[model samples]
Target: MKNIIKRNPNTMPKPVGEYSHVTVIPRNSELYTFSGQIGNDLEGNIPVSHKEQVENTFKNIERALLSENLRAEHIVKVNIWSVEEINWDHFDNVWHSFFETNPSMTIAYISALGLPEIGIEIEILAAKPSE
Candidate 1:
């Protein structure tokens, strides 16, 4: 198994979930950075609801991670963008369901997305520890 280390300082707000605010892996490990994913379904249609969009965006990230033999737990940093601000409680429910254990996250509220219905966008940085 790969060893991991948390790097958040005690002065910072405690993580609201099961993740540390930051993590460090061995220097030799392979790393992957994924682009921001929107809610577009496989058929090229964006979902209409925030929940649907968030779920699809996460699923897309999962697929990308799987292609590299990684999972959500391997993710180290996540940057999220939402139209207007997030509905925190609603977002928390969906987020915990997908991530199970949270990862380091940063969220921003943007004025708009190219598609008006797109309420959220997410990008991720992940690393797999070396054997």
Candidate 2:
């Protein structure tokens, strides 16, 4: 985490969400790009409510990081796509529970996903300096 730098330049307006405008990854770092994760349980059951799906999506992100022996701090960027209108209040709670520090992020509202049952999906880019 110390190897990465997150910046919000004075030239630009402050970010609307809890995220940095720019992230700098150090040279010689190992980067990992994960596929977009959806809100499904191990059994592939997606919740009906958008709030529940949002929560589950973060849980899945955690699992993805753990799979590579990485944690939230290793995350450099997050990209989110949602079919439903996001409830920021509920979404923030779930987001804060996972990431203690801000990361570069992008979120977009779209008409639909690959499946109707999926309300949201998140993909992340993570990096760590090679030991």
For all predicted structures, in order, the TM-scores are 0.85, 0.95
Q: Whole-model lDDT for model 1 versus the true structure?
A: 0.80
Model 2: pairs clashing at backbone N, Cα or C within 3 Å: none
Candidate 1 lDDT score at position 49: 77
lDDT of 1 by residue, 1-131 (tens): 57556566799998765456877776788888888898778897897777788878888888889899998878888888999666677777777877755677777788997777878889999888888
Question: How high is the lDDT of residue 24 in model 1?
Answer: 77
Cα deviation at 127, candidate 1, in Å, is 0.3
User: Worst ten-residue run, lDDT, model 1?
Assistant: 1-10
Q: Rate the local accuracy (lDDT) of all candidates.
A: 0.80, 0.92
List model 2 lDDT by residue over 49-130, tens digit each.
9998888889999999999999998899999999989999999999888988889999999999999899999999999877
Best by lDDT: 2
RMSD in Å for model 2 = 1.2
